[model samples]
Target: MSAEFERDGTAWISASTGTRWVPVIGLEVHAQLATQSKLFCACEVRFGAPPNTLTCPICTGQPGTLPVLNATAVELAVRVALAVGAEVAAESKFDRKNYFYCDIPKNFQISQFDRPYCTGGGIQLPSGRFVRLTRIHIEEDAGKAIHDRGDETLVDLNRAGVALIESVSEADMESPEEAVEYLEALKEIIRYVGAGEADMEKGQLRCDVNVSVRPQGEPWRTKVEIKNLNSFRNAREALEYEIPRQIEAYESGDETRFPRQETRLFDVRAGVTRTMRSKEGASDYRYFAEPDLPPLALSESFVERQRGLLCELPEARRRRYREELGLSEYDARVLTAVREVADWFEAAARLSGRPKETANWIANDVLGGLADPKIEATSIDELPLKPFDLAELIALVAEGTLHSTGAREVMGEMLRTGAAPRALVAERGLEQVEDEGRLEVWCREALEGREQVVADVRAGRIKALGAAVGPVMKASAGKANPRRVREILLRIIGEDE
Candidate 1:
């Protein structure tokens, strides 16, 4: 592949034996806010609530039923903006996007067009590149259309007026990897802030991809907007399909045949972008300021108050885990991947007073066993072995009172029987055997029995050391401190002074 294809913000396309290039991808993702009520109505925003059972007069578009803004929804949007490092505008307003659809009872969506609530933010990927955010606007979602198998379309007013945030980004992305990273980062920030569930499987988060390509050092070509991509795989597939199709058309010397200013749908199963309709510009919507609701006015003091309530975002928390707690990058990423897991780690760390040890066990043992549903039912707070109990077990290993292998057995027993760590260790006689005399006798006998391993050890074969330790541990039934066993064996074999 050419360096131009690798770094010039273009998608590399391989055809048979050759490669082509396409440039510049951007995405717009809409995440539904997690407010209990709809954006402009009192109707409950509960999912799966028997079709239109949650609808009210205002949401159903009854005459003389005026809409009211949900304060919680507005606050949630602002919180999400703050989490993503967006600037909160002191004043923003809504507009009417006129359209006709079976799902939209009002025939117009209340959205922000000219001015949005927040703007100018960015999300950094693990690769250290930033995808600049253009704006995050507040809007009201339309209703849902349930089409029956018999060609009958039923409208459900339940989803009407639901709060949603339209997160638009600048065309700064260069590849599908960057796109996925941006989406992951955005989802993490939103999840941390309690803004929305952002589950693409549930349609709570939807993404539309905008892609255009041009030769290196040239201006971009006409862009095509692909809509209704539900998953990250579909997003990448859509871009992949579109980039080649456009390049093929352009290369055929048919500029007029290429897609011009149109909306397209990604056929996930077929892996292609199909024409939906001619894309409508903002002017086509005849957007005008909403007449009913007053402009949303937020005070600087109010924005500062919201900022004060913001929690440390995932990136910052991950950095603290690495810098302050001295955790490995992989460990830090695993712990801070979810807000709940991060909280669990912090609480366990504090209680254990052994941050690294607690993190290790949580990452290895606790998380490994999380698949058992019965174990999952017990909250971390209610676990039989408290963080301190595990800390005590770790202390034993660190102090050479218990072998690392013995500590593991004690931990397994603690999980199964809910017994105290120290008590279990005592009752089972699982303490490390560190007596110099006792270990020396065992080592000498082992050296006589395994003459070949003893010969190799004397010949400076360090790998044969494990050959000796393995039998010693087996003879001790896994109770001997491994470090002491190694020390005694080395002294007898003359490998130690």
Candidate 2:
């Protein structure tokens, strides 16, 4: 029953053998806590600032400096822990994880070792699969080392003491797709709770993948760690490449070709994983409690206070949108993708009392307008228009005060000038004319020279009604209520019958 492995494009095939291999996957995600100051000092915490400008003595690890914990950082971290349903500890302390990377100013990271602040929570995928968490510990990030400039490696210390929470998940994921789902779920919760902006592009969220492959119904084998995966695509692609690479090595029965327990980096250009360094054990870090910083003691009331700050999470909001608002699945999902946009939409929906129509405006108009090069804002929060204005605009359209086309014009002007919807409608002469007499005149004028179109309408060919509606709209300069024009044309034709 022995066979060799062959490369079948992206998948590895077992030649003449029915061998099934499964990958055990987990992720260690480091999310930067949203805070104004560094973890242990008063230095400002910002991205893309000049290098070495945000460092102080405590963050830089000077001989006589002491690290003071940031209360805001702890508050933000606790909010995330609560959002994920993690159990926060009553007392947790920081330990010095001894490492000697050039980015570490102290040659040791102040981190949680034996006692992390929270434990035992998980994220549920859209498919209802729960990826469990092992622990979430608070730590400080190291500085960046730039090596792309010729042969010289440069160091930037601005990020040295930025607060971070490292959430280590259990090996519960069976596939790369599930791993990405877990990451996206985690990022949503992080942003929803105002804990952090988990933007991977700006280094706010970084991930490390630990994966091992073994034959089905076998015990776990030595796992390889894939680092430097900044994007979810890289994470999935790395796993796709590493899993088969390991399986092929084992099927070859070459002891020397077998995978080792080491860290590797994903080469995005080559679409393969390269060896980084041998994976170190916990003993290699030489963990020790920090003598300067005291143990963090949290009161139950304080924990409860942070819990109150959490709003409806994305999943709950999405469910509510579907159940209460009667929105379609696509609309529910799109509206809840961003917390700010979702909140704006909820406010507009409540104001307009037209949840479905409000969702349409947000999905079809507001979000669509953001793609315009003329709009400087990337998100709803940055736009000049408000929820109240959107609600007014939606109401105008729903009540027949503005035709859909006129409403869109008014919305465009509102976006450009931040003016009231009614003002924009009046100033642009975009209001729909619903005066019965005026509408009948335009409808009759449209049907005057189109006897065949009028006869088709009389014969109940509803599709031909567009011919009459088009002229009425054009004669009124696109300010006629289209529905009313269609009704008037039908009434006039029926009266002549």
Candidate 3:
């Protein structure tokens, strides 16, 4: 087993049979741009078009069909770059990445080499750690290959020529947890900026994780690359599994003999990585500048115009929620977990006159119930209660007109009947019973009925107070204010003694 040491807030595992520490990680995330057309072709970039139905000669890479760059893609790329604090280059160029795959009819991919469109961006994690971004480059995705169980490999050109932004980050992430966090932060930015759909399950976002293991106080070892991780959990699991396997190889005195660079594929069901092939260096791709498309040029005014349209990203919004809204970290995180949820909370808070209480109910009560799998499938906008309706409910709770239990009932009624909060409270008589004299009479009757518990309370068993409170709440059909019930119980017990 490899010894583990902490560095850069991440645990580094030692190579086998050596004192060398390996802290290996890098990420390549592919985000499918939500463009109406493909990168070099005018064909529609629809997902579920029939096989080869959406193809044109330009996308199919027919001879003499020169590729043209899409201007809108450049603007979207800049927007994503600005959202993540990246520096946009005034002039960026595209290159041809030569490779041969059956799915790629062109036998070459048009992508950016060293001079990418955007570079040197960093995303701040929730833990205040910074994950450095190496570059964000635009490229056209190749078609996909599907093999049937019995016979032949089939190719689908529907996805060919689709626009994709390959966002590469440095080997700065330390742990599987941080890796997921980085992916999530990037996904949120892309989604908020309307750059991509960013749905991992739909293959809109895919990751390639580079992992290596070394001992403490040592340089990184030769790293292995894991590709096509479809989900964040798979990315984390692949790293978790690779770290130990690599450590064991080094610990068994095989460091010098161990293969340094290789490509591995993660098997989600089997939970292991099998060697796919040897990794290739940059020279192997024979990258060269594209002749058909000219270099991209951006004016200062154009870049500034795109930046002006950018909204406050999730991290900034989260900070404002904490500072301006006076919400706890947990509450702010919950409220800002989704853009829709945050928008709804802000709308409700504006009308409720109780910002903190409105946030709490939305984050804890409303979102908590909506987490049910069935409810999650349905849209929140389709629900009966509007944002102002939720605000009204919170207002009633703050004004002491509804007990906590009664508030839940009123909320449920609002969902079912779409009634106003005050109207529901009045119609159902769900208001809390706060009349102290009436509560006193009910408490005395409860004490008389629970003779044994009353005797225990008089004998100094103060915990029996809950017993009396429960009966009072039950007597009032859960309408009694619990605080008032407690007060009446104390008074009744004192007078009896």
Candidate 4:
């Protein structure tokens, strides 16, 4: 902690000489709405389109063009509010947030000013820390600025006027880990509610991170805004880098350089934040009611209907997966983090008549084979593997018909062809060797080969039994029922005495 240099409008310095500083973060997330049309125009909200082709007079800010609110956009915004337990306002209005950029042809953005549609909600992270939200408001997105082809910046209006919901959070997050968790929790919530895809790379979701360091137990002030954090990893990285930068600035006794409240651009390549511009206060926006659009009014029935549309959110699913299904918190969180994954797991759990085993199978086996070979399945549609087949596969493992290794091979074939687990097992001769005589022969043969291990086990060195099971399993090509092989091995070993 360092002493405050005599005053400013919003800057603060630590009162102590050397107390440790901590970061406080708040996020302003702009998530594209899950709609096909733009917020004010009927332009299709499609990405990767020809430049300016998706634009109409209204979205292009042409003269005599009036904007009409997209009813679906408001409902989507309300859905997000209700999903996060925010209070939905009966009446909200759009305002002209004046600004100038190459992408915004109108030189202003239609956004919610004082009366946002939804206010007061919070998302709880996996660590159980709840980051409070300020408001969720509907807005129209600007066009894209393509800077790649030559020096002159080109504007593409394909994404212009797209529907977006801005979620502003309170500065409750204290560390980089907490900030990343908050972002992930927000992304999961948006996906769960069917609000948006929330993929950062595709520009479906974007974040502006407000990072500031305060002495322990000090109030927040002099926070710098890092703009356009495109990914959660980058968001975490920005915080990790910026928090220390500010602390060092404060420690350097440079009053003029540090503790300035301004917006900085996160240089993704260089991994540093450079000054973009001085941060604007609310008055700088000159927000006023949009004369073209009327005040948004929602019927009580409409709000209730949207509320009913809220399905089992990720957090609730997480709790149910852990409490009722007996899954570990880590496993439950992974399964429920994606809605389709949770849906698949639940349906499979019921079909297989086993909860925990199904979860383990999905988390460990089925999910591992989804999209990337290194990562596991996160969604049902990621592969040809069906939930019913997954359930049947788990049942096979549970009933001791397929050994663990054989079950994995069966699941692999199931993902490849959408074949029934039983069919694959039978086709591959994967049924566990349950015949006592066959297992005894394999066990005795293993004993004949590994007399040293048998001697060790017979002398009460039970740990050596693991060494003997492998030979029996190998002899049976991994189709041997491990428990039965162990039983037969003990029988053979006991006779060796």
Candidate 5:
């Protein structure tokens, strides 16, 4: 068998015939719509609301109750479809996917089957590789089944009848890393459109990955589906384990051990995929048009309206930041990582007319402050500090009215109390003292007994001046303008020379 070492040093061997096996990967990502109500009812769409409390007659599938679609959910799904450049259909229909699961009180999920709302768009990786999409279908989520609590399984129907959009990708990914990149990009778009939070931890977004391995020029093999991977790391780990297991199975020439069309669950603890059940095809689920809900017909105007509402996506924003603001790629990526943070930075940048400095301050000071545990506000929106105030702070530093260290202190006070940056600088006595005479005294005192540093500075090793400036700034209580201090030190060394 042919074997090669992965970057992490894991050995991946091909079949016994020395045939190189390439993994084919596809993903179905289900994102919960960020609507206020369930798909077909007015029950509040909430997470962690004491299980089953969010359910109502329509959501619970009472015998006489009929489903009335939530308009907001459809709009949210349309937003995602438009964001991804999917072709939104003029007409689509909901079908009953017949299944008997306790979590699904309806015994059949109302989902779009043949006539999904949108199709034919894909996510582009950072490498410019496009992972083509097959289709995106609208559906309702089933409730959670808690199987870990003893023998008697408990069902939480709070999530029942929640609106979801399942975006199915083609088998366009060959490696786990590409799959993850695609997922992250998709999630970013989803959040950008306000379609969903797409947080994996709260099950707002979940993925099902199908994988198979085949010889380089062979037809596709039987793909096995790994279900309900809550995080990207789990998806990658599962694929890492499964691809090799399937290759080893095929290599052994054991018919029973060959990869089959089946559903599996990721055993996160063991880092393996265990068979959940045989895969069910469309014929098995017995999908049929739901008699209660008629086919959804959308006007061209509605589609255009959603298209008009499309904001600049993260990729385009990153490009703009790089081209217009002269920011490094890393800075552009960090600024656009979140919509709120990007908006905040843009506002600050506009006010200060200093894009690079504003970006740096937001990246280092604002984001770092938000990440602190002591900061009650987790999001930029929650903070009382305004972007304009941050702009003013950046301007102060750029104007040499405040040094970076003093600006940082002012920023901390601004974050804590939403006070003006200038006021904080004044109140805390943090303004830089640029007086030539005063700074010279501190510089002269710092140069004392540091003859080697002075000698180096005199010999044209100007960087040695940094060694003397620290004690000068310390003596000046951090209020001395460091640039002016440097100039004074240079002049003193020149006079002595």
Candidate 6:
């Protein structure tokens, strides 16, 4: 595990194994495709519809009904593959993964096996470790069984046959934090290309994590698969408990008593992983090509155009913000995490022609007011304030026409009315008091009120300048420019001599 920690203000305690053992984690993320229909059927793919209402013979596996590929689903999958710099196989096919379950009405899932849509790419986590990807395959989602009621279990088939893209990562992550980073980066890429929303809480994105503990610099231990984690926090909490639990088990028991590789479920209430079933190998599921579906092929031109759909991804944008615009690494990451925010930031940066200043304003002023950092708004135009408006606000502060504090106040109003910064400043009387004559009056009042602090400054306690500045700001009703206040304070304190 990297020693650098990025909790983003949350208290994320590290998963420790007494410093002798390490946890190897790999994640299988399934993202629901953003399409209007299911993968194989034309039934309307709407969530919250009445249970079983969206089912049709095609999706329900009526014997004579055959499956057909959804063209939109495949293109979206290809876009996801390309966004991560994966190689999109020119030819791919759907296979039948046989598994008997209530959710899988067909008794088999149409999935990609042996040859997937794309393979061999990786995401570089924020910790500078690149988590390699095994493959990204297309598949159909199964329905859900609502078992919470007292007696009866109801089946919801609305999600059945919905298109999904499963991305598998190699066991490269060494800690819980790295696992979260890899998933976050993957979700960002999927969302950047308009492929999927990747909201885990809404069941739009699901994850299965493979966790194992091994002695430092040794061969693999028995790997446990934590299945169907709905949220990143639970996944992380599960690892924090599971890793130490396994280490304790190994230390306490003999070789035969140690826990082996198996499938487990993350108990959100208990904050631990409990065994669900023994983990199965690939042979357990009989895999064969779906006879109803034909091989999927794409032309070279079509593939190129799909590649052209690629915009600047989060990683690239973060790097550009850091290297080209001179933003700190933290600032860059915050700005580019959302494509809409990045687009707005780039426009503001270009208009203001000041990258660092614009970045500071957006990071501190704009995103701070958001209800969610990962906001679902699709475009900057949907935001309350436009990009040019942000640029104008930055320009006002830069020209000393507005104090930084006053700019923040104007920003709060801008978000409500989408008003221009200058207009808001005028209406609110927030313009900085740049005139030296008026500023002198405030400074003299500050000196009289804080005579002891002024005496301390004259006696060489220069840090007391802060005390003088606050009183001046208060006297001016926060309209005074800090820079001018300091100059007048110095002149009054005889420092000009």
Summed backbone clashes in each candidate are: 0, 0, 9, 3, 0, 0
lDDT of each residue in 43-67, candidate 6, tens digit only: 9988788789999998888899998
For candidate 2, write residues 398-462 as lDDT tens digits. Answer: 77788889888888877776789988887787877868899999988988889898778767787
**Model 2 deviation from native, Cα RMSD in Å:** 3.5
Candidate 3 lDDT by residue in tens digits, 66-104: 999888888888999999899999999999999999889
Please, what is the TM-score per model? 0.90, 0.90, 0.92, 0.92, 0.95, 0.91
In terms of lDDT, the poorest run of 10 residues in model 6 is 4-13
Q: Give me the runs in candidate 6 sitting further than 4 Å from their true place.
A: 1-19, 372-380, 495-497
Global fold similarity of model 3 (TM-score) = 0.92
Q: On residues 1-497, what C-alpha lDDT tens digit does candidate 1 reach at each position?
A: 11222233354654542445656788899999999889998778887788889888888777887787899888889998988889999899999999989888878899999889999888888878888899999998888887755679888888888999999999888677777878888888888888899988878888998988765556887889999889988888787678767766665578688758789999888988999999998888989998888999999888787788788899999999999999999999988887877888887788767789889987887665554566643445445555566777777777777887878888887765567787888998888777778777777777776878778878889688888887878888887777778878888878542
Report the error of model 1 at residue 199, Å. Answer: 1.8
Each prediction's Cα lDDT score?
0.81, 0.89, 0.84, 0.84, 0.89, 0.84
Q: Is candidate 1 or candidate 5 better by lDDT?
A: 5
lDDT by residue for model 5 (1-497), tens: 13332333122434346566788999999999999888998899888899889998898889999999988888888888888878999999999999998999989999999999899888888766789889999899999999999999899999999999999999989888888999999999999888999999999999999999886768999999999899999999999888888887887789999999999999999999999999999899999999999899989999888888888999899999999889999999899888999989898899999999989888888888898777789899888788999988988898889998998888888887899988888888888997888898888899999999999987889888899999999999999988888888888888987
What value does the lDDT take at residue 297 in candidate 2? 89
Best model per TM-score: 5
Window of ten residues with lowest summed lDDT in model 3: 13-22
In Å, residue 315's CA in model 1 sits off its true spot by: 1.4
lDDT of 5 at 276: 99
For model 4, name the residue pairs that clash. 367-376, 367-377, 368-376
